[model samples]
Target: MPTGTPLAASRSTTERHDMTPSDPGARRAGADTTLVRHLNRRTVLTTLRSHPDITLSTLGSLTGLSRATLSAVLEELTERGLLEEHAPATGGSGRPARRYAFRATAGYVLGLHFTPNQVRAVVTDLEGQVVARERTEVPPSVPAPERLARARALAETATSQAGPVWSVGVATTGVVGPEGRVLRSSQIAGWTGLDLVGTVRGWYGRDAVAGNDGTLAALGEKWQGAARYADDVALILSGRPSGQGIVLGGRAHHGRSGAAAELGRLLQDQTWNAAAVLDEAGRTAQDVFRAASEGEEEASRLAAHLAHHTARAASVLVSVLDPQLVVIAGELTVGGRPFLEAVRLQLETMCINVPAVVLSELGDDAVPLGAARLALDALEEKEYALEG
Candidate 1:
């Protein structure tokens, strides 16, 4: 598995198919050529996305398509600028075969992570590279209109810098519906029912998808950060407004109403005041972490307080899911080694079987990066419907 390979399934599926008449979905009598051509287009596109350096003979052998079919599909894709044909290497004994590569920068996507405390935006190419980014802090008491205004500005600025975006992805607090609707949000004050999809869709005039911050952050970690190899993972998002992200069998679990990983409510009434713990003594979580890192006893105590509160919530999730790994992400990561150690200690005491506790390699940027992954998925056939 390369650092940014498309995914394991993409490669495995191609290996089993040899696109001949015997294939299950192969065209038959009275079949539509337009539909078949579109199907072929999608198949070639997906194969190259995962195996960009494939040669003609290898592609033919893997796809089970004849040379003439591949040539036609390749020509159509090349004309659209989604693929490129490289000059064949001269080292081979016979006539060298040309290589094919996916044009990762052919288009860009905008990924936004909006919360009551801050708004972050990023522009990623087709290959999930962050070419541009913008982030701003917001007061906890700010009204929804003010919060949205600030986020919209950041989105516009980042999009312009990264060129035209093909689609949009939004990450926010609360129970988000598939259409980008905010069904419920206690953290955002008055931001519920804002219809994020419609608003952001209008902003970029492009297709968009929205999801819970915790869920997306979890996905961001699985896709590009820690938990890449773990089949099941629990991500504890520690900050002023803490949440959770769950991954089961290598996919994000959103529950019945997108509240699967929202453990904030359970801890709010009993365990600890997350706001009081993360923001205290007029110091931000980052400042407290720096002070603790410098050996300040008071700051160290506060860091433990945060870990204790987070670990309690984590213990509950671990008992049920019993994931292979537990990841700590968000501003809490600024606390460094000591903070994570404290969380692991708490978990060890509470649960008979504690998973490996690790810090999110993507850190605070995890949410936005995951949002980019959402937009990238929309470009694939699985996420969209073909039109005649």
Candidate 2:
């Protein structure tokens, strides 16, 4: 069968039967068949992506599909260049059965992080493996149009050798609406009212997605970082401006107006703004943590002060959402156990119930990685719609 041709089960049964053309039952059966085929194809693709190089027999067992159905699906995928068949490498086998793997290199996706000081881009394949990355420094004094142009150039450079890009995702520091508009951003001057999605789509000639950096960081952790196993998570992203992202029931919760967990905006009577505090000391959050790690009393004092504010912010989230895991992400967490332990201790004291608080494993790449994931998801949705 041709790659794009519908499977027998997905075709109209009325065409195969001698029933009248106006038979309602036959039409419903055909529609049901098409829906079932679409679902089965999605299931097979999902399973193959999760378990690459799986034997056909193993795939059938994992997907619970009969041999005939599995064979048809595999043939179609292979014909479409989305799946590759290979002989199993076993020394004792009489005849190695063919194994199948998703073709990760078939297409690529672009992810970008646009900030006041820097623009970073990453190219990933269908399997979410990083293919290429580029970073460009953008001085704060640069005009908004110039900064955006530079960001676009960086994205183009990053994906130059990655082949065809299926989708694009951009992560920015601000309140990003569902339609990809930057509603508000204090870090980047004149950033509000920017059509982030439109700009990115123009650059790549494909539909794009945009999201808040902190929210994407939470998704990054849930996708492949520290919070992978947690169903409900709150991510505290510490940087020049700290922010928070909440994930409940395995999805990022972007509240009304897409500003749900703006932890930096949370009111506190006596809060320690880590960025402001460190700036007053002529140091960065990383510098304070480094000094504390080296046993500097003054540095430890500053770290503790910052921890107090972080814990206080977390306590509010814990009290309200009661997440299963609280993740401390970004450059500050690079201080390792000292920073995490300090924050953990402070949270234990403030919260009525302390959840498992830990540090993010993805570090600086979290936002970009999460953006790539969003692009991948968009591609999957498009494919599913076409199939359906």
Candidate 3:
């Protein structure tokens, strides 16, 4: 689990709302209180997320729940193994208080990221710690069905040795439509019009979800990377399909058709995807970036070409959204400041308002971690069924 302020250290999950306990003398006990009880449970669980070793008093304070109601919620959670109690600790002079923490190991989630050149899968606990991982390299010529089968096999194998998995999330290279359907994927042959969400669900026979890689990476960055504090952000991932994802007001901004950031077709001729350039040069992005940073002319020229196109698209997005920040992900991050400066310089000329552009700290893990975050959403928000 990440050691920082709860979830996004700089943000709060649920605001402290005044909540009153139910009347004990009600005639109908189980009829009316079921939904309320469930809500209270969710509140406690959400409050404890990434916030550990909290005493009852503090939990009550943060949640604004009455002591009696808070105690009942904690007892229910402890009974369900979602929380664990720690030994009593003496603090400032009152009686010792028993602390409780959310048990991240209560259940697990599977996340998979797929690009034209590679497939990566990870099984992470509820707190986003990778417990198992699998990867494979595939030529772009591989058929879509074959690639799907390989993805299924890798995902199944990755989760075999881990704890019980509650749900699965997939990040793929394409314009994802409603219900995880691939609206279009020109880079990978025969990949368009696939029912990705249903396909992944068949693999696990449980809850599954799918989304565009760049879009999910945006969510991942907000959850753990550079945009945690930014109210609005735009992210460009220079991987296969070279698309963008937008975050507005701390939530993903998927347009009506889930194609808000599908800029691959427009970018294909202008900006060569970073991996394709690196692969043809027979060099890694890191190697190219390092040489460019040292003032190598050839490397610097190639890096500038990539930066120019990235900035063009970013400039358009900045003009429209006027976001507070912009993030560069995937191979482009290795170029660091030189690449960013080039992009920023170009952006300044094209657009009057330019936000601060930075490299993604989550690196290759961004998509997968974001997929895990998606799976968690399935468990907590959508279906609201994590059984355990």
Best-matching candidate per TM-score: 2
Highest lDDT scorer: 2
TM-score of 3: 0.82
Worst 10 residues of 3 by lDDT: 4-13
Instruction: Give me candidate 1's TM-score against the actual structure.
Output: 0.84
lDDT of 3 by residue, 1-388 (tens): 2221122111112222343235444423433455466666778887898478998988988888899999877765665557789998856687889899998886688889988888888788888888987899877889989999999889879888686667888888878886888898876768899988888888866678888888888888887898888978899987454778888888777788888877656666643566667667787777778898888998888888788888877876798999999999877777788788898998898899888998998888888878887877776664233221
Best-first order by lDDT:
2, 1, 3
Model 3 stretches with alpha carbons more than 4 Å out = 1-32, 90-96, 239-241, 265-268, 271-296, 383-388
Error of 3 at 8 (Å): 23
**Local distance difference test, candidate 2:** 0.80
What candidate 2 gets wrong by more than 4 Å, as runs, is 1-30, 88-96, 268-271, 293-297
**lDDT per residue as tens, model 1, 42-112:** 77777888898889888888888889999987875665556788988887698888999887766788889
**TM-scores for every candidate against the unseen true structure:** 0.84, 0.87, 0.82
Candidate 2: residue 280 Cα off by (Å): 2.3
RMSD of 2: 3.9
- lDDT, candidate 2, 219-326, per-residue tens: 878888999999899988875547788888877777888888876556554345666777778888778888888999999898888888877777878889989999
**Cα lDDT for residue 197, model 3?**
84
Candidate 1 wrongly placed segments (more than 4 Å): 1-39, 91-96, 140-143, 286-297, 381-388
RMSD of 3: 7.1
